[model samples]
Structures are given as structure tokens and as C-alpha cells.
Target: MAHEAHSHEHGGGEMNWKLIVVSAVFLVIGLFLDNVETFRFINPYLVLLIYIVAFMPVGLPVMREAWEQIEHERDFFSEFMLMSVAAIGAFFLGEYPEAVAVMLLYCVGEGLQDRAVDRARDSIKRLIAFRPDFARLADGREERPEAVTIGSIIEVRPGERVPLDGRLLDAPAAFNTAALTGESVPRMIETGHEVMAGMIATDSIVRLEVVREASESAISRILKMVEEAAERKSSTEAFIHRFAHVYTPVVIALAVLVVVVPWLASLFSAADYAFSMWLQRALVFLVISCPCALVISVPLGYFGGIGVASRKGILFKGSNGLDAVTMLDTVVFDKTGTLTTGAFRVEQTVGLSPEDLAFVAAVEAKSSHPIARAVVEFMQGKPLATVDSACIVNVPGYGMTCGEWAIGTLRLMKKQGIVYDEALNEVAETIVAVAHDGRFVGYILLADTPKAGIFTLPQRLKAQGIKLMQVLSGDKQALIDKLIAGFHGHGFVKGYGDLLPEDKVSHLEALKKEGKRVAFVGDGINDAPVLALSDVGFAMGNMGADMAVETADVIIQTDEPAKVVEAIAIGRRTRRIVLQNIVFAIGVKVLVMVLGVLGVATLWEAVFADSGVALLAVMNSIRPLHRPRFEEK
Candidate 1:
């Protein structure tokens, strides 16, 4: 299921606004009776009763929670424990107004924290809404997406979303894939082309055969991955949790020392110091030393960062993935699917007759390779002679041969001693040599255009101090080199082509051995091995294979190379904001604790130290959610 049973509902359950209202009313009356001389006729005991009544609404819940922690979990030093103890201690010291106000402010702070988290969760939820709720069946009846079965032909009109992953059964049409790929460009998909869910048909009506169930669709899986991301904590979050475990008990012990040690020193030195005065300071110390700010703000910062990434069409599997992205110094890319569009088109046909084209198409039809598929797609309009595939011979790496005609790469031609013109080898396009029996027939040129803004991606990575950026592909070395040379202005450190799946992993392994934090980016299915082996794996979500999406730690939903840089920027910003909160929370609390114990800081200062700093930290966590300069669009 895309959504799960979350323990805490986003945006704290319906707030006790009535309780807050009652507390505020009693609090105002109590302060007026105590401070204003006009109300001096009212009994002091009655005013104390008003203060106690005001404290009850907010304080009772905190006290019960503290009690539950002690009785059930054998735990102390939680935020509830500190607030409850401090409030009760202040009340006993006859500081009734301070006690009531502390509880009131803490409740307000809790409400604010919950609201901040809710905002971040809602931002992410908006991105996951890409999945269409209904699919138009062939019979023109719209049904729930989950009820749509595989092999069911669905009709989608212009502006309607494709409800499930399917293969187009109708003629080619334009689709707006911004929701899926994060790019606004409309893509033209042909008949038999696979289309993912969450894409909107923008031009003409399109019919497709559902290839996957709703639960197994790409949109469903992406939503599921994002929903579960928060369960996996980062190293910083785990450390803060451990720190709270030890820090809380130690600070509580110190608060006890602040009271007993001062009173004992006063007795021994024969100095005039009231026990109540020392005890009041100790209560203030407990209030100031609460660690709610650090604990709550750190996780909220990571969530905010994840929300920002989702807006840019990037999905981090966890905060750890976001943390890892901040530390990445090296990035590896797969050429065909990662850097280039991976959609091959026929650029030119060389010295080929209609009969020769038919022969080439017949031989390519027997292969499942992407280049072969491109060849078959190009031969759609041309008249082709029908040839039976009863005796087709398959050859890996080289090409295939059907009876008399053989079609493949120049390497295959070289192996078979079929002579071909040397001029064909000089072209940058992927050359497919066609031969009949013992003689060379002709060659067809196929080209996969690089995606827009890909060249700018390397430069941006370099600007961010990414030390190494390279492309690894199984295409010809000359083709890869020519492609890299075209983008001479960008910082492409190296390009290695003619590599198999294992070869890519070997290169990545070598980089890891050099003690560098390596990130491998590719369309998941083809680069699964390398993606799994790297320190961090980034998958092209929009066009990525299922295996890649499942294995990758981060998925670029937009399939845009620039989003990688944006992801890194968000990661770095999140880490900085979290650190700022931790340091600021701890630093302010420590300073306030010292002042409180020294009798310089009062209950008013304690309230700000506990609740005010927490609000500030929560506000700081949403910094990354705003548009960064590069992501203005």
C-alpha cells in the first residue's frame, strides 16, 4: 500500500483549543488579582486557586505523560518530565504565576512544532498525488485505478492522466510528463511504446493496454518509497537520540545538585541564604535545560529537505540518503540512459536499396537489443520483403544472422572478414553494418541525442566541488569520445565506452577503494549491479527500470540531470540547518542553565530558553523549502 498506518497523525490531532482558552482566561484573572492593587480586596488564597486552575488544563496532560514515562518506561528527563517538575516546584515555592505561564508557553510550542511538521508532510503529499484516481476503460466507463486489470485497453483523452503503466496500442501522440519526469517538455510516444502512469495525454486521444496492476505501477511504488522514508533515520538523528538518553539524566542530576549543594554550602559557611531561594533557582534550571528543541527540530529539518527534493522531482529513500548525498565527492553516470535520451533515431541510411533495407530489418527483428529495436521502428513506413526467422543465428556482443543476410556492428563485420568502407568508422553515429552471405551490403546510422541541460550538469557538479564526473557505457569508444568532445566546455573528467555491466561495477569498485564517497547514477534496470555496489545510488525514476528504482537510495523522478545538483544542494542545506539547530539549542540552554543556577536568570528567562528556542529551531528547519536560485522555475 502507498500509505501506511502512521503512529502519529501529521499535524497533532485536533488541538485542545477549549482548554487553551480556559487556561488563558484563568491565567489573566490570576495575574490581575496578584499584581494589580485594585483587586487587593480579593483573598490571596483565592488568587492562588485561580493560578492552580489555569495550570490544570495544560499542566495535567504533561504531568500524566511524565508519570507514564516513569511508571511504564522507567524513563525520566523527557520534555514532559522537565516541564512537570519545574512547574510543580515553582508552585510549591509560591511562584504561582511563573508555574502557570511556563506550562501555557510549552503547550503553545508543542502546537507550533506539530504545525511545522504538518506543513512539510503536506508539501511531499502534493508531489505523490501524481497517481490518477480513475482509468477510462475501452467501453468508456471510468473505474477506480486499482480495479483496472492488466491487458485491459484504456482510452485517455487529451489532458487526462494515464492511470497505469501500459503499452500504447494507438498511433503516436504527445504526452505531458512533467508530473513524472519533472520536465515540462511534451514527449512524442509511438505505437507499442511503454508509457508510465502519472503522464497526461496532451495532444490527441491515446489507447493503451495496461501492462501492470495499479499497486505495481511506477507511481504507486514511488509513493510507497517516499512514505516509508522517514522511518530510516540519519546518523545525526540517531546520535541526537543517544545524546538525549544520556544528556537528560545528567542535567536532571545537575538540577538536584544546584539545590542541595547551594543549601549545604550556605549552612557550612554561615552565610545567609534561604533554602526556598536555592530551590526556586533549581526549578528554573530544570525548565531551561529541556532538550525538546534539538530533538524535534533535527528530524523536522530532514523532512523539510525531503519535501524540497520532492518538489524538484527527486525522491530520497531516507534521511540517510539525504545525508549521504551531502558527502558525495564523486559521481558516475551511465551514458545511454543517464546522460543521453536513450531513444535511438535513424540519423542516416548509407548506400542501402529498398531490398537491402528489408533485409536489414528482417535480421534486426530477431534481436531484442535497443539498437535493433530502433532499426525495426525506423523500418515501419518502408516496404520490407518478408523473411521467415526459422534459421536465425544469435550472436551476443556482435550481431545476428538470418540465413543469407547478416546485420550488426563493424566488429562483427571484422570478425566475419566482410570488407566495408573505412569512412563509415569515422562517423560519430552508432553504425550498423549489413551484409548478405560473404559480401558487405550497406550500413545504417543510428543516433541517440543527449538530453537538454546534460552538458550544464557536469559544470554545476564541478562548481559544487565534485572531484570526479565520468560516463560509463556499452556503446563504441569512438562514439562515446565524440559525444564527450562535443561538450568540451563542461568538466567531463573521462568517458569509458564498450563496457559491459560487470565492467561498470569494476570501475565503481576501484573508485570506492580510493576512499572516495561515490554516487552512481543510472536508469536502475540496466545499471543495477553498479548502483547496488556504490556508496549511494541515484536512479532516473521517470524512465528507470523497476530493478533500478528498488535498488537505488535516491530516485530522480524528473529524469533531469540538473536535479542531481539540486538534490545535493538541498542535502547540504538540510545538514547545515540541523547542525545550526543542535548547536543553537544546546548553546542557549547551557548559558541559561548557568545563569539560573547562579540566581541571575528568572522563571521568565527559563520559559524562553525552553519554548522560545524550540519555536525558532522549528522555523529554521523549513529554510530549504524555499526556491534556491538555480531552481527558480
Candidate 2:
């Protein structure tokens, strides 16, 4: 059967394509008429008539957007209002070409701003495309997908997106999570693995009993967050709103005064000079008064910054959060899953020789388990000989093995008539015991190890003026103590173990109270609340839970701890560029407006004042795209 394409009522890509084509047509017509000598002989009035017709395709939409804001009782200060009023006034002064030039240039600027917004929104829309549309049931039935409403259950087969929030009902499966995490790798998931929607199944088909419907799933919530963030205005946008609030009505009042006062003054002064000269000056003021730079480039800057961060695997909840990250002075990290690998590994192995150990290791490696992978990673360089064995078994939270040579939990060894040896057990690190033909052999120990370069990360952060480094985890005190001991006297390295999700939130709140900028780093379903509550959150992408990545402000795509430092540097550099753009734009506009009011500038100067500043601000706003600073540890 041919599958139907997923449809939405939102009219995706249609309006954008129309805007692009219309903008292109207007630009071409304006350029052709301005350069053609044949058109120069045409009355300037007739030429403007043609130019206004050309401008309508782009100008009508701008007018419509302004009308919508007015209808919704939103503030009446918009760039469209400024452009429309200025062009009308210019025409009244018999400057038809100047009127057309003002509207045409303004149209081009609006088109560029719209294109940038569309690009940022398209990035988020691509994220939404990962939603699954079909499910294959366990009863040999394929089900037609329904709308992703709240509380709906859906089934997912191997190589399909998990359609809803669910728990595994059958054996373990492997999942390729590159779509959500930005890590191009697959992870193994066993029974009771909290599976979220939008993850692709890689190996083995396992049944997932849906708990939350597709709409209420994590992916749906994340999509909503991203959309809200894109729409949320930055501080620069707020300033523009306030400026327009006063600037628009004030300009209209000034234009009225210029018309009435000049006629009033005509009785005392030369009448023709007062009428023509003051009216011309009023039109020039109107052209210069338009806040085109603020209206066009401020939102573009915010949108572009957000888009750049998303490309680097950072998910800013809103422009507010994106701006906040750049201002942060200190970044706090949750230790267990953020800085560490978050999985157990064989730190050391003892007792048995290399040959004997390989046989026991092969028996334990037979099962699909996290501990099994840890053992394999530990024995990476050691020679291993395969042993022919049947009756391979797995003990949950314990161990596994083949035949009489059993490698499993301490309790399993005791049950199998094996004697306890404390000295050898301490040396092995993780609890792993072996039994050969119903006799006790030896065991191996494992622990969750720190990620590469984690020990040296604090030094780099301190050099960047990050004053505090704290490790908060739910792991037991013994493990936390081990981690603290590993980093003793390394620039305020401390650990608080056995913290619940709520406890972590409380700790972040306290840090905020102390006027400290805190950034939480975590992975796992339990860390979602803490991630959302912190000033900024960074999640470890590889092996991280879906909730962590979605909640985090920044996601480290690679396993290296050094990326944390690099991300901070990127944040600072982007912020510097934003400030530079704002200062340059506002300063130049003020100086030029002063000169124009004193009769030192003309209508052409006004055009350059409005459009040139806007263009420069836009160019500066996108500087982060080329100069992204990555720190080397």
C-alpha cells in the first residue's frame, strides 16, 4: 500500500515562496526603471506611478502585518507605518522618485528580515518532521496513525520512530538516537528502559506499552518549547517596541505642526519660501525618523544567534535564555552523567592470569548487558579465546556466564557453592565472581569512570573566571567520595551525593539566591527538572536520556568534557558581537539625525542614514557564524 504523506493545516513553505518571488519581482522592476534612459523622459509622476505598482507586491504584505497588529490592539509603532507615512509625505513635496526609493528600499529590508526568520523557524520545523506516523502491532496488524493527541497509545517496530512515551514490555532492544541527541551512535535498551517518542529502533523488535500519548510525549513538548523560543522577543526587540510607541505618534504630530505652523508663519515671512521650504524639510524629517535599523536588524540578530546555537546542538528555550547564557559568570555541573561517562566500567582486574581470565570474561560477555560492555571495554587489548558453551544465562542486576565456569554476582557465586574472598574482591573494583565446575574461582570489579579530560576541566574553567565547581549526583557517598578524592585541591572541586531531582532544584535556587550564575549539566530522566530550573543546562548527548537533551539549554554532542569550555567561549563571543552591533547602529543613527535636522543633509542622506545603518547592523549580527570560538583544553 502506498503511504499517505503527513499533512498539516499550517500551509508549510507556501507563504515563504510567495514572499520570495514577490520581493524578487519588485527589486528587478525598480532597478530597471532607475537605470533606463527611456524612462527618464517620462514624467517623474508617471515614473512613480509605475514604481508604486512594482512596490505593491511587497508593500501590501507589510501593510497587512501592520493592520493585524492594530486589529489585535497591539502597539501601533511599526516600520510599515513609518515607511508608508514618509513615502506619502515625500510625494506631497513633489519628490516622486524619492518616495518610490524610500518604499522600495524599505521593502527590500523587510524581505531580508523575513527570510532570516523563516530560516530559523525552518530549523525547528525540521525537528518536528521526526514524528512517527504509523505503527506495527504485536498481533500481526498494522495500524493507521491518528492525530498526535494527548494520552494516545501507539506501537513501534524495529527501525521506526517510537510513537509515544512507553516502557518496554518484552526483551531488550537497541536504539539509534542520533536524531534527538546529535550523536551518531546506537544505544542498547533493555526491559524497563524509559523509551521516549522520536527515537529510532535499531536492532530487535520489543513491545512498548504506551504511557503518554503522542501529543504529551517529550518530543511534542520540545517542539512547542522551540516554537515559543523563536517567537519570544529579545531585549533589543523590547527597546524597539518602546521606541516605536513614542516615535510614531510624535512624528505624526511633528508633520502636522510643520504644515500648520509654516502657513501661520507665512503672514510675517515670505509666503512661498515658508510654504515650500518648511514642507520639504518636514518630508526629510519623516524619512529620517523611521526606526528602520531597530525594526529590521534587532529581531534578525536574535533569530540568527538562536539558529547558530541550535546548529551547534544547543537548544535555547527562548531568546531570554539565549541572552542569559552569554551573561553567565559561573557554570555549575551535575557530576554523574554530565562530566562522567555515567556507565560502569572495569577499572581494574586481578587474581586470575590472562589466559584464565579470558575464558571467564567470555562467559560473562555472552549476555546483552551494560556490565557486559564494560567488561569488554576493559579487556580491549587482552587476547581472548572463544569457548564453546551452551546454557548461557543472565541474572538481572547481578551477572551472567556459560556452562560450569560462571561469572556473576557475589550472591550468585555464593549460591553456586563458591567461597567469598574479600581481598580479591576489593582489588577487582566492581562485583563480579566466577565459579568453575561448582568451585570458586575469582571476580572482577567495576565503577563508573570519569570522562577523558574531566580532571583538567576545572583548571580551564577557573582560568575563565569560573569560581566554583561542584558535583551533584544521586550516587552513593562512597562513589562520590572516590570522585572527590580523585580531584582533591583542584580549584574548589566538591561533591554532594545522593541528591534527588527536587534536591538538585533546591540547590540551584540557593545558588541563584547567592547571586551566582549556575549552569547544570546532567543526563537521565530524573535530571529533567534540575535541567529546567538552572540558569543554563548542558546535557551529555551520547547515552543521555531524551528528557535531559530536551530540557537542556546546551547539549554537548561529543563525549569530551572540553566541549563545555568551548561552548562558554562561543557564548561570550556571540554576545560581544551583539553588543557591538547595537552600539554601532544606535550611535550612527543619532549623529546622522542631528546633522539632517540642522539642514546639513538631504533626502538622499536620509535614505543612507536609515538603510545603511540597518545593513551594517545585519552584517555585524551574523559575525558569530564565521568566528565561533572553540577552546582547547
Candidates' lDDT values, in order? Answer: 0.83, 0.66
Q: State every prediction's TM-score relative to the real structure.
A: 0.86, 0.73
lDDT by residue for model 2 (330-403), tens: 66667766777768887656576687677766765665677777877677788776866556766666667576
lDDT of 1 by residue, 1-633 (tens): 000111132124565656767888999999888889888999899999999899998898778777766776677667678888889898998999899988888877777777787787886677567888789999999999899999999999998888999999988888988776666789898788899898889988899999999999877887888888998899998898888879888988998898788778887897887889888888889898888888888988999988878767889999999899888899888888788898887888988997888877876777778898888889998876777778788878988888777788898999889998887777778888888878998888989978888877767887766888888999888888877886674555688998989899899989889998999999946699898998889998877888998899999987777778887877887888999999999999989989998899999789977889998999999777765643321
> Which stretches of candidate 2 lie above 4 Å from their native place?
1-68, 128-178, 184-213, 216-222, 232-236, 250-273, 353-429, 433-443, 452-456, 459-465, 476-478, 481-489, 498-510, 525-529, 539-563, 625-633
Model 1 stretches with alpha carbons more than 4 Å out = 1-15, 132-136, 140-143, 156-160, 202-206, 346-419, 422-428, 433-444, 489-492, 524-526, 630-633
RMSD to true structure for each model, in Å = 4.7, 7.1
Q: What is the lDDT of residue 403 in candidate 1?
A: 78
Tell me how far the alpha carbon of residue 106 in candidate 1 is from the true structure, in angstroms, after superposition: 0.9
Candidate 1 residue-wise lDDT at 61: 79
